[model samples]
Target: MMPSDAPPPLPEDLFAAARQARTNAYAPYSRFKVGAAVRTADGRLFAGANMENAAYPQGQCAEANALGAMVSAVGGQRIIEVAVVGGREDDPQDLCTPCGGCRQRLREFGTETLLIHICGPDGRRHTTTLGVLLPLSFGPDNLDIV
Candidate 1:
């Protein structure tokens, strides 16, 4: 068991899980595998890999998958941080950030201050916030729903 006051897992630790998740990606079309991990406020981590489909746009991104797992296991939990890792073995420009749609999807669960890390499978890392990734974005509050 971890101490209550123990520091949350480091970015690299989350990236490592994302890297492992990437191996399970089902990307036969684009061949671009992506993995994502989400850390909840309580330090719980959930990881997911991209699943592609032959039918266009009938696939789920790694970020969405991770968020789905997080919410399914812990309803009403807010995501505090997110780390995404992806790329191809042949042309490795990993440091994969959430796509536009994924960013919006994440906004549904994470606050504007949520930390986001884009990382390569080899451990390259970059950090930013959801607000930075999607500035002045429309969200639940925009509709007076939050």
Candidate 2:
């Protein structure tokens, strides 16, 4: 088994998985498709596609879906790396970063150093860390619940 703290592997296939998941997005309302794939410290991969709802606020982001999948898995909660791809269906080129809510959600399960790989159909365009995306944020640890 790989070490518990090993750095996440940056494989091109991770981006490929996100891109492929983008094709399955249910974004009929905004026509904006987003896909997200996350790699845990344990070397597991999970992918998710954005789903929209007419109610708008009820819509689920791709990142949330991916994170949900990871959380529902057997073990491991630390996401070492994430790949996200999103854009208008006709032209998928915008450097679609995770929204503020998703960023906070990510921070709940990832360290400040967790890598967020922003991708387009062509491939990765930028890479940022959770600290850079959501600086001085609140998380599970912030809760005082016993």
The candidate that achieves the highest TM-score relative to the unseen native structure: 2
Could you tell me the TM-score of candidate 1?
0.84
Q: Which ten residues in a row have the lowest lDDT in candidate 1?
A: 1-10
Candidate 2, residue 59: the lDDT equals: 95
Stretches of candidate 2 off by over 4 Å are 1-10, 88-93, 143-146
In terms of lDDT, model 1 sits at: 0.81
- Model 2, global lDDT: 0.83
What TM-score would every model get versus the actual structure?
0.84, 0.84
Number of the top lDDT candidate = 2
TM-score of predicted model 2?
0.84
Q: Across residues 7-83, which tens digit of lDDT does each residue of candidate 2 receive?
A: 34557878888898899999998888899999888888889999999999999999999988887874447788899
Candidate 2, backbone clash total: 0
For the record, the alpha-carbon RMSD of candidate 1 to the native fold, in angstroms, is 5.8
In model 2, what is the error at residue 89, expressed in angstroms? 7.7
